[model samples]
Structures are given as structure tokens and as C-alpha cells.
Target: MLFSTIVATSRAVGTTRSRRTKVEELRSLLAVLEPVEVEPAVSWLAGEPRQGRIGVGWRTLAGARVDPADAPSLTVSDVDRAFTELAGLAGTGSTGRRRELLATLLGAATTAEQEFLVRLLTGDLRQGALEGVMTDAVAATAGLPAETVRRAFMLSGQLSVTAAAALTGGADALTAFRLEVGRPIRPMLASPAPSLADAYSRFGGDVSVEYKLDGARIQVHRHDETVRVFTRTLREITGSVPELVDLVAALPCTSVVLDGETLALDPAGRPRPFQETMSRFGAESAHDLLLHPYFFDCLHLDGVDLLDAPLAERLDALQRVAPEHRIPGVLQPDDAAAKAQFEAALAAGHEGVVVKDLTAPYAAGRRGRAWQKVKPEHTLDLVVLGAEWGYGRRTGYLSNLHLGARDPDGGEPIMVGKTFKGLTDALLQWQTEEFPRHERSRDAHAVYLRPELVVEIELDGVQVSPRYPGGVALRFARVVRYRPDKTAAEADTIDAVRALLPATDSG
Candidate 1:
């Protein structure tokens, strides 16, 4: 099959919000894709390219090389060779070479193929269809049930592995499989629930709620005395957190697979700023940075596989094998008690809580009602500093808005973040018209607005950053609504910002 055909199908899949439509499009494309072309198609749709910067003042860059003549000769083996070569270049050489290589490869493709390739390389293919959608597509193409494909993916971390299984062994083979160690499985995630009460109602009874810390998710695999840790994206970081490896090595079990969040905490036992924890992992002397791992689930224990086990059983095994300091108990209770516990967790400075059904098995890579996160409604007061032109559906509107907090001692506002989230089409139109009235200047793609609008913003949490002028940036920040009642001078200040900062070890 031609690359353009795959690109066309991907475009059709992305444009339609309906899962059925996506599945159908993928199935039609898969039917014509020769086995020899499958790997290349997958690589072009999922691979990440090398990136970096030349100097402090230079913009970060991506690498790709495309020769039009090479497009006809492209094969699955060639794609595999390119990805292997690109991965090898990730940590070496000037950033320019990598960017050039990537540009060359992508430039070789036709326009539609280039669009698909760009989205895949940038990791921002907002089609709401990733591995899950692919699973459905594979199942539809192979004449198997979606559940069968899902199970195969759960056991084998690779989508290609699942595809091969569906194409050869058929659906029955998927159901008979078990997961192996040393090989990673996609991590299960919580689905959004309407409300805490609603989540509790759905679970009926016998559920566990755990504090959802504002930290990075990790999977720790231990064999005898050796342990390895990986992030949600499956990047190895065992060397970055040597202390965590030591902690896992000390577990009583001979071999175990544990899942949890790793957060940096203060001597007072409160969670430290998220930036501190993230910085700890990337620091030159990671050991110098105090970090802690809180184990919450056990997927393997003492030569036995626990992936097929229920959550309650896994939690029990996790507590038995892991040390007390490292294993925090899940919050299990009745409806009223769970809500009270959630409120208590929030009051104690936790992000929120994740409620899990006791009997549900780990649904790797799947977001389902088996687990749900309950975070408090987010809101903040921010001053608008600028606006950027919108794209796609947001075209002709001031979609991206720059936000800042007041400077201490009354100086220029310090820009902390920018966001395009939480804007209705009507709101976008209003901002596009009103922002120019306060415009300080206009650029090719953005309008610099005067410090005039004060809006109520909301976010998950504040993270430490070197990028923002305030030395801090908001995580998942979005506009709650326009706070027209407040003037720019009345917007929140740096001292107020400092007050909102989570208590840290430095204090």
C-alpha cells in the first residue's frame, strides 16, 4: 500500500469523533496494507524524532530529512532502520544534524503523509485515538472482538505484537496469554468520573480511595537485588533515582513488580513542589536530591504473576512485600467516609484522590470506570498579558492567552504561563475583538495585549520552572471565566503567588 493511503485513513480516523467511524476507517486501511508495509505504517504514525538546542538564545529544534526520490524505495525495513538510527542519535551530536535528518525524512513524503508524520513525531496527534483506537481497528480488521485485542495489548506492550497475534493466532490466542517480566505492559489509567458521589455509586460498595499525589507515575521492576524504574512513557530512569532502586532492592520478596508515584517530600512529610521532584530526576547528582517512592499496586510477586489478580489482592501483596514507609494504604470505605477522606486528603495538601473498585483487575493502558480520580474544582485569578492567533477550529480568534501575576512591590506583571484551554467559540470571538483594543503591538501570529484584563484561571497545580519569569508555572492551567469585576492592578501579586506555593523543604 502507498504511504498516501495510510495517511488518508489516518486523516479520516482523526477527523471523526465517533469510535465506530475510526474503527471502520482503520479496518478498511488495514485490509489493504500488506504485512510488509505494516511496520513502516506504524513507525510513521508513532515514532518520536531527536530534538535539542544549539545555544541558550536559540529555539529548541527537531530533526528530519526527506528526499523525494527516497519515498518510492521506502520499506518497513527502511523505516525500522531509520528509527533505530534516530534513537541512537538522541543523546549525541549537535541538535542541528538531528533536525536536518528528521526534516529530510518527513520532507520526502507527500503533503497528507507529511501531516500524519509531523503529528506522530511531535506526539500531539489529538485524535482521541491512540493505542486504544488502534486496538479497535485491529480487531475490526481481523474479525475479532475488541476485548480480544485489548487483552493482547495488555499482555504485550507493543501494538505490532498485538497486530501480529491477531493476524496469525486469532482471538483465542490472546485470551490464553500471560504477561512476562523484563517486558513492559502499558500502565492502566483512571477514567474521568462525573463526581465523587457518582463514582462511588457506580462501584456500588467495596472500593478503595487513594491520595492522588501531584507527582510522576512510575513502574518499578525488581529481580532479586536489582531494580529498574520506568516512567509512564516507558523511558528508563533507574540511574536518575538510585535511592529508589535501593528502596526497591530492599523489598522482602525475591522478585516483584510494583506501581506507584514518586514524589519529593519535605522533612515535615508534606509533598514538595513538583518541579523539585522532576528536577531531582534530571539533576547531575540525583542522589543529592531527596526523593521518595510510594508503592500502591503490585503486578508481580515472588515468581507469581498478579496482573490477573483483583485490586484488593494486589494491594495486599504490595503491602506484604514492600516496606511500611514505602507502601501507603489505599483509602477504602463507604460513600460518606470516602468523601470525608477525600476532603481530608485535599486539606492535607494532596491533589485529590483516586477511587478504585476492589474486584477490578489491572486494565493495562485502558482508562475505565474501574478506577477514577476525584480532584477539587480548580480556580485562580490571573492578569492577561498577551494573546496569540488561533489555528484549525480556533482560526480568526485570539485562542492562546498569556497570563501573569502581579509583581511584588508593584512593578511589571510577571508572565507565569500561557493557555488556550477553556475557551468557548463565543468567548474566543469576544477576546479576539476586545484584545486588540488593549493591544500594545501586533506580530505575525500574536497580538501583545496591555495589562488590562483580569481573568479567573484554574489549574491542576503549580510546578517549579526555569522557563517562566516567576520561576514557577501552572500545570494544566485554563481559564475558568473572565473576572471583569477586577482591574489589572487588583490581580493577585507575587507575594500572594508565593503564599499559594506548596510548602517545600527550603522553607
Candidate 2:
């Protein structure tokens, strides 16, 4: 397939408000791709590169200047090979070589293809129709059930590969995907609950109220003597924390997959600051920080796949394998009991409590309402669109920030508000120096970035807005911290912002 085909399809996908139109746009492209080219094409159209981060940075991309070809002639394989060569360069003189490679690739591409290449290489493909929408497209093109496609996606954690299997091998091939002992499946996620009383009222009876730990989520996989640990996004970090490896290997069961949290603790066992935990969690080598694991749900136990089982059965399995490590929780309690549990979690220095339906099966890769988490304050993981230069005492630094919420339909972020609050001298200095590296285009007041960085922002509430693209604006927004572990793809959506709007309006 020609690379221009992808660029045109992506434009169509991003411009529409209707989801059916987006799926059909993607489906048309998927139907034409050969099996060998399926993965790269799907990955690129989903606003990601199959090569991941290939050492290309803003400085590298900014330096490349090439006159694009008038005609579209670059094949999908041709572009993939060019990226392969770019990714293979390293060490001395590698920078210049990468630049040469990028220039050559761009020179061969048409104007539209060049723009697409820049966006894909910079890791800021702003087009909507991410993994979720593309999954439906795959199902549409392959003539398979959407549920089967989604289930395969959750189990494999790679939409590219799932799409390939479905297109070539069909439903039976997708059914072959299961919770393997070594491969990490996508973790189930929770929606926010307004309050404990609300959660109790919603679930009525037989809810598992558990403490919500303020730590990095970890998924541990053990097979015989070997153990592997993965983050929520399914990136392996087994080598960084040998202690966690040993701990999971000691579980009573021979083969198991445990979903849990890991964090550095203070002397008294209270959770450390999120930054401190991320420092250790994101490390390449072990430091003084030692991480401890807390098991919450077991997906696989002794060759039995518990992902289809109810939460109650899964919790029972978790208790049997690692009784002491099970997260503190109360099952099937009254509203008062659940409220007390929530209080206990808060008093014990935890984030909050999660109320879950015991009978609900684990919905991997789906943020369903079966589980809900209650917190003390409203926090949104928003993308940093850009930042402005500082003034007066804060001179020579990037102070005010332009923030945006993710467009749930998979379009570019919708700018909601701006903030200059919640910065220390350290952060101000860091942003002033580093923000430029992400700059897509700049102006006098602000340097607009490609929207790759995710920051946790605390806000008072949201209000109607005519200026912002989301039709709402944040109230009293301030940065809590930068989330280095998260991606822009994972940021909270514009729908989440509008959700905070008042129930009734006279307008």
C-alpha cells in the first residue's frame, strides 16, 4: 500500500465526530493491506510507530530539511525499511547518520507523507481513532466479532499483531490468544466513583471494598523458577527489581499471574511520594530504594485462566497463593461497613477505596463501571500542550502552561485552560530548558509543543466555555506533578472534563 493512503485516512479519521465514520475509514484501509504489511500500517494509522522511539528527538527532526516529492510513490515497506536503518544507527557519528536517513526518507515522500512521517517520528500523532477504534476496524475488515477482536487485543497487548491474526487467520486465530504464563495481558481499569455511599447504592450488595494504594501498578508473572514483572502498559522491568522477582517466585503456586501495586516505602511503611516511587520504579538499575508488592487480583493460577471468573473467585485464588500479600479488603458488607473501610483506608495513608462488584468478571482493557474508586480530590491527567516564559522573580523560566484534555474520539487534544501554579524552582528550571525539545511551533508568548507530555493537574471544577474546543474550561487548575510513567494516549479525555460541569444550565 502507498504511504499516502494512510495519511489521507488519518485525516478523515480525525476530522469526524461520528465513530461509525471513523471505523469505516479505518476498515477501508485495513481491507487493502497485505498480511506482511498489516502491523506497521495499523500501528502508524493508530498514531504510533511500530519501531517505537527510534532515538529520534525534536532536535533531530527539527534539523531535517527536504523538498518533498510531488508524487506519492513511497511503499509501506520502503518507509519501514528506512525507519529500520534509522533505528539501527548508534554511538559516534550516529546523530549525523540519523539526520541523513530522515532527510532521504522525507525527500522521497510526498508533502502529506512528509508531514505524517514527522508526526509519527516525534511520537505526537494527534489523529484520533487510537487502539480502541482501530480494534473495531480490524473486526469489521476481518469479519470477526468485535468482542473477539477486543479480547484478543486485551490478551496480546498489541493491536497490530491482533489485527494481523484476525485478517489472515480469522476468529479461530484470535481465539488462540489467551492469558499466557510469560506474556503480560492488559490490566483491568476502574472508573471514578463519586462517593462511597454512591458506590454502595450502585452495587447494592456483595461488593468488595479494598484499599486503593498510591503506587505504581505492577503485573507479576511466574512460571516455575522464572518470574517477570510488567507495568500497566505491559513494559517489562524484570531486571530492575530482582527483589520483586524473588518474591513472586516464592508464591505457593508454580505458575501464576498477579495484578498488584509496587512502591518504595518510608521507614514506617507509609507510601512515599509519587515522585520517589517513580524514581525507583523507572530506574534501569537497583538503588537504595526497594520495592514491595501488594497483590490485589490473580488472573492466572496453576494453568487455570481466572480472567473469565468472577472477582470473588479470583480474590479467593489470590488469597490461597499469596495470603499475606493480598490487598486489605472487606467483602459483601453493608453501606456502613463499606464507609468504615473507606475511612480506614484514608486514615492509614492510602489514596482511597475501590468498591467492586464481586460477581463481575475481570474486564481487561475495558474501564467498566463494575469497579469504582473514590478519592478526596479531583485530579485529571492532562497533556501539556505548551508553556510560556516566566516573568519578574520567575524570569528566564517557563512558568505558565497550556493544558488540554484528550479527545476521546482520538483527535488532537482540546485546549481547556492554562495554569502557572504548583511549580517549584526545580520544575521551573527543568521546563524552561526541556520544553523547547518538544516544541512543534512557537510564538512570542508560548512555545507550542507536540502534546507528548502528561501531567497530573488538580482542579477546583469545570465550567462552560465558548473559547475552548471542548466547550468547557477548567476551574482553578494547578499542576500536582509530571507523570513520567504515563503517555499522552493515556491522558484523561475531554468528556471527563465536561463531566465536571454542573447538572443544569439556564443557557
Candidate 3:
């Protein structure tokens, strides 16, 4: 198929807000792809290339500009082959080699196709072609149910693979996806609850309240002597976390899949700051900052699959296999008892608690209310220093806010962090209209303001960050509301922001 066909569909999907229209556009595109083109086309439309990060950055793309070809002749296979070659480049002269390849690729693409290729390479192809929408489109094209497609994706942990299966072999191929022992599956997700009372009220007494650890999520898969650990995003980090690999390999069973959290601990046994735990994940070697695994659910044991089993049965399997590593929790607790567990989790320097429905099966890759997380939310009034140009659905609006904390001595608002979350349509429109009035400077990416607008920001907490002048940054920060009643000088100070960090992390 022509690459222009995919670009046109991507544009159509992005311009429309209607989910049905987006799905239809994607479905039409998917239906026409040849067998060899299925994976790359589906992946590109989903805003990810099957080759996965070809090391091309905006700078490289910017420097290697070629005039567009007058006609559209590039095929889907042509682009895929170029990306595959790019992904294989390494070591000396790879940069020059990549530039030459990009130049050749762009030289053959028309203007629209060139734009699409640049966005695809830079990881900015945010059309409404999300995984869910594409999953529906794949199912529609293949005459299969959406649930079947979703299940296949969740089990395989790769939409490209799932799309290929559905296109070639139809329903039978999709249902064949199972919890393979060595392959990583998407971990189940939890929804946020306002409070423990709300979570307990929703699930009644048949729930397990477990500590929501302030650590990195890990899914460990072991088959005999080989153990592989994957992050929440399914990135394999087996070499980075040898300790976890060894621990999962030592489980009594020959093959098992465990879902859990891992964090560094202080000498006194309290959980270390979350950043400390995440730092080890990026390192090639295990550091002095060792991570201890805390198993929360068992997805597979020996030859049996517990993915279809209820939480009770999964917990039973977890208890039998890795009782020593299971996360601290109480099963079937009442409202008051669940509240106590929440308090205990907080007291242990962990994130609050996850109240899980004991009867629900593991809804992998889905963030449903079957598991509700209740955490103490903190809010701060901060100054909006600038705003960035939005893309996709947020096009033409000033979306991401550059937030700053007040300097008590009145020097300047110190830069803290940026957050684009929690902004509604009304807020987006209001900011687009109001922010320019306070604009001090402009750039290609952002409009810098006078730091005169105070906005209320809700956050999970704060962590030490050398990235900011205050040496701390807000964690999971989102817009609450614009504080029209407050001024920038009256916004939360740098000292106040630093105080929000945990005592262990504040230093």
C-alpha cells in the first residue's frame, strides 16, 4: 500500500473528535493492508514504529531537510525497510549513516508524508489513533469482537503482533494468545479513589487492601533457569535488575509470573525515595542502592494460568509460591480495618493503599475500578511561568503549563516542573485567550509569561530533583483550578514546595 494512504488516514483521525469516525478511518486503512504491511502500518498509526526508537531526534531531522518529491510513490514497505535499517545502525559513523538514510527517505516523500515521517521518528505522532481505537479498528476489519482484540493485545503485550494475528488468522488466531511463561503480559492497572471510605464502600467487605508502594512496577517471568523482568511499559530490564532476576528464578515452581513493586530501602527499613528506586532501572549494573521486590499478585504458576482466576485464587497462588515476598495486605477487611491498613501503609513511608475487589479477575492492561487506589492528595497554588503549544486534540491551545514556586525573598519564581494533565476544554480555551496578555517572550515550543498567574495544582507529592532550581519537583501534578483570588507573590514558596518532599528525600 502507498504510504500516502496511511498519512491521509492519520490526518483524518486527528482532525475528528468523534470516536466512531476515528475508528472507521483506521478500520478502512487496516482493511486494505497486505499481509507484510500489517504490523508496520498498524504500529505507525498507533504512534509507534515497529522498529522501536530508531535513534532519530528532532535535531537530526531538522538538519537533514530535503525538498519533497513532487509525487507520492513511497510504499508502506519502503518506509518500514528504511526504519529497520536505521534501527540496525550502531557504533562509529552511525550518525552520518542515519543522516544519509533520513535524507534519502525524506527526498522521496511528499510534503505530507515527510511531516508524518518526522513525527513518527520523533515520537510525536499523537493522532487519535490510540491503542484502544486501533484495537477496535483491527477487530472491525477482521470481523472479531473488540474484547477479543483487547484480550489478545493484553496477553501478547504488543498491539502490532495482535493486529497481525487478527488480520491474518481472524478470531481463532487472537484467542490463541495465552499467558506464555517467558513472555511478559501487560500488568493490570488500578483506578484512583478519593478516599479509603469511598473505595471500601464501593467494593463492600470482599476486598483486599494492599500497600500501594512508592516504587517502580515490575513484572517478573521465570521459566526454569531463565528469568526476565519487565517494566510496566514491557521494556525488558533483566540486566539492570539481577537481584530481582535471581529472586524470581529461585521460586519453588519451575515457571511463574509475578506482578509487583520494587524499591530501595533505608537502613531503618523504610522505603527510600521513589527517584532512588527508579535510578537503578537506568543503570547497567546493580548499585549499592539495592531494590527489594514486593510481590502483590501471581499471574502464572507452574503450568497453570491464573489470569482468568479471581483475585482470591491469585492471592492463594502468590501465598504458596512467594510468601516471603508478598506485599503487606489484609484480605476481606471492613471499612474501619481498611482505613487502618491505609494508615499503616502511609506510616511505612509508602503510597497509600489499593483496595481490590476479591472476585474480579485480572483485567490486564485495563484501568478499571475493580482495583481502587486511595492516596493522600496535596495541592499547591503555583505560578504559571509559561505554556507550550499543544498537539493532536489539543491543537492550537496552550496546553502544558510551566509552573513555578514563589521565592520568599522576592528574587523570582523558581522553576519547579511542568504539567499538562487535568486541563478541561474550558480551561484550555481560557488559557489560550488569557495567557498571551501576560506573555513576556515567545519561542517555537512555548510562550513565556510574567509568572503573574497563580493556579491551584493538585499533586501526589514532591521529590528531590536537581532539574529544578528549588531542588524539588512536584510528582503527578495536575491543574485543579486557576487561583484568580491569589497573586504570584502569595503562591506557595520554594520553601513550601521543598517541605512537601518526604523527610528522607528532602535532604
Candidate 4:
């Protein structure tokens, strides 16, 4: 198919507010794409290049001044091949070569196609739809179940390949995308619990209350002698952490996949600060920071796949394989015991507790009520949209913050609230020095940002509001910390914020 067909469909999809319309348009586009063209087409539509990043940044794109071609004739393969070369460029003089190629590619595109290229390259498609919606579209087009496609995606860890598989071979093809011994699947997620008591009441009989550790999530997969560790986003960091490889490879089982957290403890046996643990990434640490793995669930063990097994069964397998590394937990049925465990987790210098439904199978990528996490206080990761200037002792520094929540529909973050509290003098100094680097626009009072920085904001609660676009304002929001490890895409969503609303009489 011609590249213009995809571009026009994308424009049509972005112009509408109805999700049904978006899915219909995307499905029609997917229906026409050749089997080989499917991956690139879907990847572009989802605001990412199939080649990933492609060595181009906002600076390089902004510096290029290529004119548009009069007509549209570039094929999808043409763009994908160009990106393959662009992404392969490295070394000192790579910038000139990449820019030359990028300009030549952009010079061949019409105005609309050029706009699409810019959006795709800059990670700002603003199409109001993303991989999640496109997954639905692909499923609708293939006449397959949505869950089938989602399951395939979660296991395969590649939506582009999964979509193509469903399109070319239908639901039967998805069955092949199962838990492999070495491949990392998307980790199972949990929903936020209002409180420990509420979560205990929800699943009283079949629940395991476990310590919610303040550490990095690691999915260790082993096959024969090979062991690979993947982050939450499935990026492999095997070469970066030598100690982890040794620790995971020493497990008793031949083929296993364990989901767990890795952290370093201080001298007093308390969990070290998150940054200190993160500092172990490349540095030879002080006092030889040992990464302790705390296994909570096992997806695959020995020769059996436990992804479909209940949590109780999974935990049993985890205990058998890595009994020494099993996370601290207790199978509790009474509210009093669960509450006591929650308090114990906090007292141990952990985050809080995760109360999991013991009978629920491992629901990868689903943050349903099967697993609920409760912290000591309410904290949310929100995007910083802008910052207002300070006065008096904080003069000339950016003090007040404008915060936003990720939209449920994968659109831009919605403005929910703002705050200047909880920032130390050092934070204020850092903001003054760093805020200008991310400035998108500026006024006398505040400087608007690109919504790229995610800040952990602790708030009392939320209230009904007429001002914010989300129809709710965060009450007493304050910055707890800056999450450099996370991106704006991972920020807590507006739907999550709305769930904090004060209860009604009907409930």
C-alpha cells in the first residue's frame, strides 16, 4: 500500500473523538496492509518507529530545514529501511550523516507526510490512540478475541509482531506466543488499595499479604545455563549487572522464570534509599552493595509454565526453586492478621504491603483487584506541566509546580493540580538550573514544560473541581521526589486519581 493511505487514515483517526470511529478507521487501514507491511504501519500509527528512537532527537529534527515534496510516493518499506540505517549510525561524525539522510527522507515527503514523520520521530503523535487501542483494532479486524491478542502481546512482548501474527494466522497463531524460559513477559501488575483494612475486607478468605518492597522490579528468566534479567519495561540489562547474573544462574532449577525485586540493605538491615540502589547500575559501590532478590511469583519453573496457575500454586513453585529468596509473606484470612502484617511491613522499613487474591492466576499486564497495594501514605507519580516563579527567600527560582495525570486513552496528560510544598532548598536550586532545559514556553509568572518530567506527588486526597480538565483537583499535593527512572508515559492516570474521590451515601 502507498504510504499516503496510512497517513490519511492516521489523520482521520486523530480528527475524531469517538473511540469506535478510531477503531473502525484503524481496522480498515490494517485490512489493506500487506502481511510484510503490517509491522511498520502499526508502529508508525502508534507514534514510534519500528527501528526505535532512530538516533534522531528534538534538537536534530528542529535543526533540519528540508522542504516537502510536491506529491506522496514513499512506501512504508522505504521509510522503515531509512530508519534502519539512521538507527545504525554511531561514532563521532555520525550526526552529519544522520542529518543528511533524515533531510533527504523528509525532502521526499509531502506536507502531511512530513508532519507525520516529524510526529513519529519526536514521540508526539497526539493521535489520542496508542498501542492499547491499536491492539483492539487489530483484534477487531482479525475477528479474534481481544483477550487472545492481549495475551499474545503480554507473552510475546512485542505488539507489532503479535498484530502481524493475528492478522496473518488469526487466533491459533497467538497460542504459539506462550511463556518461554528465557524470554521476559510483561510483569503482572497490581491495583491500588484505598487502605489495608479495605483490601483485607475485599478478599478475606483467599489472600496473601506480602511485603511491598521499595526496590527495582526484576524479571529473571533462566534456560539451561543462561540467565537474563529484564526491567519492568522488558529492557535487558544483563551486561550492566554482573552480580545479578551470578545470583540468578545459581538457582537450583534448570529452566525457570522468577518475578521479584532486587535491593540493597543498609548496615542496620533497613532497605537503602531507592537512589542508592539505583546507583549500583554502573558504580562499584561503597561497602559492596549486595543485591538481594526477593521472589514473589514464578511464571515458569523447571518444565512447567505457571502463568495460568493460581497464585498459591505459583508461590509453591517459587518456594521449591528459590526457597531462600522467597519474599516475606503470610497467607492470611482474617482482617486482624492482614492488618498486623501490613503494619509489620511498614515497621520493617518497607513500602507497605501487597494483599493478593490467592486463587487468581497470574494476570500479566492487568492491574485489577486480584492484587492490591497499600502504602503508608497516598503518593502518586504525576507529570510536571509547568513551574511558577518563587518570591522572597525563594526569589527567581521556580517553586510552584503544575502537575498532570496520564490520560486513560493514551492522550496527553490531563491537568489535575499544582503545588510548591515539600521541596527543599536543594530541590529549588536544582529546579532553577534544570527547568529552563525543558521549557516549552514561558511567561512572567510561570514557565511551561514539555510534560516529560515525572514527579512523585504525595497528597491528602482529591476533590470535585470545575477548574481542571480532569474534573478533580489534588488536595494538598506536594512533591515527594523526582522519578528520574520513570517516564511521563508511566505516570499515574486520571482514572486512578478519580478513584480517590470522597465516598457517596449510596456506597
Candidate 3 shows a clash count of 0
Which candidate gets the maximum TM-score versus the true structure? 2
**Model 1 clash tally?**
18
Task: Go through the candidates in order and give each one's C-alpha lDDT.
Answer: 0.69, 0.86, 0.86, 0.84
C-alpha TM-score for every candidate: 0.68, 0.95, 0.78, 0.93
Question: lDDT by residue for model 4 over 283-398, one digit each (tens)?
Answer: 54333677778989999888899888899999989888888888999995577788788888999999999989998998786567899999988888898999999999989899
Can you tell me which runs of candidate 2 are displaced by over 4 Å?
62-64, 90-100, 126-129, 505-507
Alpha-carbon RMSD of each model: 12.9, 2.1, 12.0, 2.5
- Badly placed stretches (over 4 Å) of model 1 are 47-128, 172-177, 326-332, 378-507
TM-score, cand. 4 = 0.93
Ranking by TM-score: 2, 4, 3, 1
Q: Over the stretch 165-187, how does candidate 3's per-residue lDDT look in tens digits?
A: 99999988988999898788877
TM-score of 2: 0.95
Can you tell me which runs of candidate 3 are displaced by over 4 Å?
Answer: 91-93, 126-129, 378-507
Stretches of candidate 4 off by over 4 Å are: 8-17, 91-93, 126-129, 282-287, 432-440, 505-507
Candidate 4 lDDT at 387 equals 93
Where is model 3 poorest over a 10-residue stretch in terms of lDDT?
122-131
